[model samples]
Target: MIGVVSNSRHASDYSQGVRAMADFARKCLDNWVLTVNGSFEQHQKMIRATLAKRAYELFELRGREHGLHLEDWVIAEQELVHHNLNGNSSGFCILVDCPRDPGIITILSVTSRSLLVFQSRAMADHNPELIAVHLLPENIHPEQTAVDAVDGVLQVHLPKQRNKRRK
Candidate 1:
């Protein structure tokens, strides 16, 4: 995470810490550098470690402001897909990710309830690879697996659904 860097120890410099960290993370993603060879498994392992490191780096960079941990925030993959709630042919693309594979970023179909919903770690905890709510009409329950990315740390499985709603 690289953003606004401070030259001296001033109180205001401390305040821009968030922006600085955001810049840093963006740069890391944009200019991510990795070198490895061998089996696909080996390559994925390296990517997984890299993703985890970036997540922790983000947490550390922002520690000066919110005092948060790596797990405290939601680490959604940057990809987005279109979502349809009203059964419209065309859908709106929103930034969201499956809890299971946070790295294989994609959009989702959320009802009005989750329209503007941004997830926290509490929400993504063990979320299934939400490959579109619009499942195939005749598909059976398939097995779980890690995301196909540089990192393979994507958690698989949806959160347990409860009959009770949040109060």
Candidate 2:
């Protein structure tokens, strides 16, 4: 009877594991469908909502100042854009998992002007910093490039430079 009980318990555990795996698979499929079906208009609406929320938070953080609403909105929009560029689900720090070794780096994006955003953890055990350096092209406008660190992830945006046609 002991052998029978052991087999039954093992089968129960196996079934529970299979159910968990199925649930995870279903969630992944749902997320993929949402991502694929999400329209540009929908994305823009979401961005606008995020900007509004961030602007409100900024106002609250500043002790609810009466004026500077436009300034707050602009800053909040920029902040939200930067946060989204970091590929974070929310405007929060994303913990990057890496093997316990130095010199491991991941390049997130690179522009035509060679401007790039790469992720590399500090080599030192103490005071580890997530380093992201943007190399700007000499002809590129400085204002066009924005660098921000969010949730240990570095985001660098480099707008394409427009070529001037001379007659």
Best lDDT goes to which candidate? Answer: 2
lDDT by residue for model 1 over 1-167, one digit each (tens)? 11122223343322222112222121112111111111233223323443444566566677645645444333512221124322222222222233453333232112212221112232333221222222111211121111222332222221212244789
Error of 2 at 114 (Å): 22
Across 1-167, the per-residue lDDT of candidate 2 in tens digits comes to 00000112243332222112212111111001000111223233334554576788899999999898898899876644332223222122222223323343332222232322223333322211112222232333323444444544334444545667999
TM-score of 1: 0.21
Summing lDDT over every window of 10 consecutive residues in candidate 2, give the lowest-scoring window: 26-35
Alpha carbon lDDT of each predicted model: 0.26, 0.35
TM-score of each: 0.21, 0.32
True-vs-predicted CA distance for residue 154, candidate 1, Å: 27
Model 1, CA-based lDDT: 0.26
RMSD of each: 18.5, 17.4
The per-residue C-alpha lDDT of model 1 at residue 90 equals 25
Scored against the true structure, residue 28 in model 2 reaches a CA lDDT of: 16
